[model samples]
Target chain A: MKASARLVVGLDPHGNSVVRVLRSQSPLTLVPARRVGPVALVHLVSSVTSPLGGDSLELTVEVGPGASLDLRGVAATLMLPGPTGLPSSSVLRFSVEGSVRYVPEPTVVTSRAHHTAVVEAELDGHAELLLREVLVLGRVGESAGTLSTSVRATRCGKPLLHQQLVVGSPSIDSSAAGLAGKRVVGTSLMLDAVPRASDGGEWWNVVPLAAGGTLATALGDDVVTVTRVLDAI
Target chain B: MLTALILADSRFPGGGHVHSGGLEEAAARGLVTDEPSLKSFLHGRLLTTGLLAAGFAAAAARGEDLELLDAELDARTPSPAQREASRAQGRGMLRAARRAWPSERLAALSRDPHQPLVIGVLVGDPYEAALTCAYLAVSGPASAAVRLLGLDPFGVNAIVAALPVEDVASRAVKELPALGSPALDLLAEAHVRREGVRLFGS
Candidate 1:
């Protein structure tokens, strides 16, 4: 039992305030297609209306020259089992000419659920991007499943960042790279700009990407503290 | 295998000693204050960063583009402090590698190429390259644990010897998924900023 979901949002400038969302799709699939407001000024605005879990999910987002957009995920996704204990997979591809912000809600790795997601983005010289992800091992008192993630981003066709994360399950010794013992973990990345945090808190571990970008990682005993640190960007 | 053995030696002057690979930071935060904790720390690192580095190292050993491999590595590394530490060591390693291997590939890299990329280019076999990378990834930290926590040297060595380095490399070569540790990343960021006596570079 393998189900699939796909969403493609293409944004181009129509006027100073309103941008055109040339492509938007959330066809009838296991993962719900839900969104609202391509509201003015900052290109198009869209989001995943509900929590999602499927055998495979593919997302392609394109921002036209000088356009800016924000893609949000409303609730955290739980990686439930597919038909035959098959792994859940999500592939996100981005083609950006201007800039894009993707701040999705956390995805919980429940017991026995194995999920892997890959994010690939190609950006123009002037384009910028912001991506944030949070992973929770269990709900209240439970061991975590397995979640593997990969990110590949390019600027002007040059690779800017290629990052990978595999956590939980196999390593019964320590859960989720040892961070689960402390509870929650999150990653925030910003390209072509510095992450300005008004809090000035010491919660985040920050770094500068070689070509051009910023990466930060934070953790907390609870989800709120970790999410709060990620929200700094 | 001989080349990997020589390079994997912490004494190869590749600047591997300068980095704690996040161990110093973790130990300070109380995440790794004891022997069992240290083992878990090393194991976690091996499964994530170690695996990824080995994967890239193995890929690089397969005659991949030097520039392309380094760029891909940059994309994979999300921590700035760790990134800087990597470049610093890379620069040091490149300098040493050029003198030893002295190839056109070594010369093509920028002033400070990444350490794994340098090792990848010089190693003859992908598995060897990966094993070398994986070995060093934890060996450096295990040594650091001895200095910082004054843990039994014998115990630390035992942990290193007990690791599934071969399995990690094999899986890495098969599919190196992107994985990161926010808690460790935070520790690294903090370690660099910590004012008092710092033992290792990263």
Candidate 2:
């Protein structure tokens, strides 16, 4: 399956954020809330079983000046293998002039599944973005297949943070320098001017980026433990 | 080749010895208590951070813009501790290289550039620079393992020798790698917050 979804949010004269353009494709549904407010709430629903091997998905989100968008996911996505044995891929691009919060639910990389996910965000001056991602290796008693996920965020054409994480390869996954044998990995990227003190634990930490922003990362045996650390940040 | 060898040498006084590359913390946590565990840690480090550094080194050696590479590397390295470690080593290497192999490119580097960029400017060959970077990435941690865990030196040397450093270097030269080592980053941060006796800087 191949799908492309687009959503654009802009501010009105009354200072209320409104969704100007919303185009949804199968498995990439965007449902906006009925409430009127300064911030627009949109729920991303996967209307169909998606992201199987050989599937390609793309989502583009743009926020105009002074607008705010709260985009969220409804449920966990399962990366299942298709019969073709090919790899699946998804690209999420965000262009922000105001603010955006993209909080997607956890994604599970099941056995035999191979997927590549990339998220690229461009923010101008005074723009803010918060992105959260939680990845589970596999279902109970099952080992993960393979996943290569990357995130690159830039502000005013200068890079803020860019990272690529690859999972699978039992050796690397179990290594102390890699995932440290953890089953769940989570990260929250906050690209705002908020100054946060450096804090961490045995398997989690929140650190300031060199250019600007803060990244909170946690690894654990279960989703709840990992998410708890990220939530604390 | 000689430049690469000298920069990779432990006695070069680049201050690379002060950083364990997260091995100290791993050993303190009992995550790498034995030879096998040390091998796993080194392997993971090689594939992720090692690959990323080697790519930047290769790019630098290919005569890429120093300012742009520095900023790009900073973007790639999210952890401030890790970034500090690299720049600290880079400053050390730069101070020494100024007298040994001073060049316009070396002067072009920022006040505190990345260690890989220093190695690249000194080596002047992409493959050799990447090879030097990838090897150093595991060699430091390997020696740190021997010191921190009291592992057999011969066994650790064997492990490091058997690692696929050449393969990683070759792959690094193809493109700039953005691989991120989450566990290593956590270990580095935890090491900074350990609030006790510490042997290595990072």
| DockQ (CA atoms), all models | 0.53, 0.94
Residues A1-233 of candidate 1 have per-residue lDDT tens digits of 23233333344344321234334334213232243334222222223322234555666666766656666665676666554676777778888876778887787777777788899989888887888888787676876777778788888888787766666644522532346365466877788766443122345665777788777677666779888776655
Cα TM-score of candidate 1 = 0.85
Among these predicted structures, which one has the highest lDDT?
A: 2
Give stretches of model 2 more than 4 Å off. Answer: none
Report how far residue B150 has shifted in candidate 1, in Å.
Answer: 1.8
Instruction: Give the clashing residue pairs of candidate 1, or none.
Output: A161-B75, A162-B75, A162-B76, A163-B76, A164-B178, A164-B179, A165-B178, A165-B179, A207-B80, A208-B80
lDDT of 2: 0.95
Q: Compose the digit string of candidate 2's lDDT tens values, residues A1-233.
A: 99999999999999999999999998999999997889999999999998999999999999999999999999999999999999999999999999999999999999999999999999999999999999999999999999999999999999999999999889999999999999999999999999999998888999999888999999999999988888878
**Model 1 alpha-carbon drift over 4 Å, by segment:** A1-54, A170-180, A194-203, B175-177
Any residue pairs clashing in model 2, and if so which?
none
